[model samples]
Target: MVKWDEDIYNTPAYPVTDAARYLGIPVVTLRSWLKSRPSADNNDQPALEPLIQRPDPNLPQLSFTNLVEAHVLRIIRATHGVKLDKVRKALDYMSQQFDTAHPLVMKRFQTDGVDLFVDQMDRLVNVSRSGQLAMRETLKHLLTRVEWDEEGIATRFFPLIESVPESEKVIFLDPAIRFGKPVIAGTGIPTASIVSLIDAGDEIEDVADEFDCTPAQVRAAIQFEAQNRAA
Candidate 1:
């Protein structure tokens, strides 16, 4: 079996727009975040480094780490009202302290770094205890999506579909399945395949029956793909 982390880290499979759609962030915003832009202050200073390095050298694709980093950023943005500047500062501090390129996506963040980062973030700015807890809670929820390896590293991420309810995870990104594209749980059928069948005028019920999945799963796939296409 292909190791989960290897399946993710080694493949530049996730296009920026697809990842942005899945992550509920704007494509342009996500692209901007991934770019190393010239500093506004002075030309002499170094270009700003991206939060997560591009997975593919030739193209702008996000690895699982980039996806996870963006997911955490979404949480921070929605939950804490944290500016990108503050989040970047916190990431820089943790990256320095942990000696890791992406601390938020690494296993150590869950084990030890969450509290450390949160405390350090409090020092950087006044965040209430409630706010801190909220952030931690959001991280916990995000962590649930990750399937860890024996070494405690993230191997797979069961990304939640936005159109689906919190109680339901109709699809996920798995390195061992469908070349890591989003698919329904238990079967490696790509969500796009289902969407394609429906777009061809096939009945959702027949597709579900053929795939041995629920109607809800079929609809979820179609909804997710349609949303991404629209975006």
Candidate 2:
């Protein structure tokens, strides 16, 4: 619930590499835009401010507002009902522009890029705001496809971040909890109940489609059961 600042929306207060990570773009792209100069206006407004990095030869002279505005619209559309206030807040933090209303205008937009932007934004905000709506199948698919950096091994995916401990696992199994079987670890819902749905000819996607979990979590329960069976 930490509200961000309105000023400094696109300024390089943080490292460009970090900013690119937040924006889900490559640092090279961001740097390319930064070096470009803005088109001259009839009234002769000064060009966009450049990100003052240790001068690199590869920097292009381009308009910076275009890049910033693209990110703003992309984030706003992705979040759905992203309050003007919130968008403004995010902009202030990212750009470091204190003036809320800048005169810069965007000439064109890339719809495909916007969609890609949304995908990354969802990766960041979906869990915190709309966990229920997030597709479990999608989660399972991602977990299965995730590549571990250390060993280059593709191991089974688990909802470790949201897993219930054994001590609290029983609590999740209580009939009175989470509509009688949520497997909440301390809340309601049995983890096995969700997995059972998967075993009962329902696809993991289908199982999570009706349940309040990702497909990865549904699989976690199955894996947990397999381990118990082996032991």
Candidate 3:
């Protein structure tokens, strides 16, 4: 078991809607991923299992860790067009092999789990060798946005505010800061707060100066909020 800090990241902090907004995933899609439902084609078939377990099964909320898992799932199932069944199988295999419920957020996933996951997908879906390589590379790139602690559990996540380089960490979500809300990377200023200032008719440069952040950072905050709103 990965020993997550119970009071911090593991606590149910975000409601289903909030989590979906932060992850740029559709609310209905996220709900389906969180709550198992009968297949549309056949109610007689077994209900699909949820991809990520909520911190409190009794509540319809997600912990920060769950958000991370959803983020990764978005990249795999949505961006890469990987099938849901294949993803579930790959995650199950990784869970058994790694002895951790949340394998995708673990630090070692970048080093070891990516290849294993890709190989499993290849076997399950018969993806071409080149497709396997592409999947591996894509997964590796996705893992770059997650930052893990000494215990190999994810501590922070850098969400893409725009179509920028992976190495550009302009905005981040840390459980320790702003109740896990996305903030300007190093300044601890909430991106939404920055956008609020703009909405209030404050100049971007003035907001940046007020926050002691660069104009570029203020623009990033606007971009992040715009993306969330558009989603």
Each candidate's lDDT (Cα)? 0.77, 0.38, 0.86
lDDT of 2 by residue, 1-231 (tens): 221121122222334553343344456756654553553443375554433221233433211223344344433434354433333334333333323233112111122222333344455455343432343223222233122223221211112222544222222222123422225342234666766776788888887668766666666666655444343
* lDDT tens readout by residue for model 1, 1-231: 865445555567788888888877888778877877676669899987876676665777787767878877777776677876677789999999988777777778886788887888898788899888877777776767766667665656766666687666678886667777888888878998898889899999999998999898898898888777777
| Residue-wise C-alpha lDDT for candidate 3, range 85-161, written one tens digit per residue | 77888899999989988888888888888888888888889988888888788878878889998878898988876
Clashing residue pairs, candidate 3?
none
TM-score: model 2 vs. ground truth = 0.23
TM-score, cand. 1: 0.87
Worst 10 residues of 2 by lDDT: 103-112
The better-scoring model by TM-score among 1 and 2 is 1
Report the Cα lDDT for residue 134, model 2. Answer: 43
lDDT of 3: 0.86
Clashes of 2: 31
| Residue 43 of model 2, lDDT score | 36
For all predicted structures, in order, the TM-scores are: 0.87, 0.23, 0.91
The candidate 3 region of ten consecutive residues with least summed lDDT is: 1-10
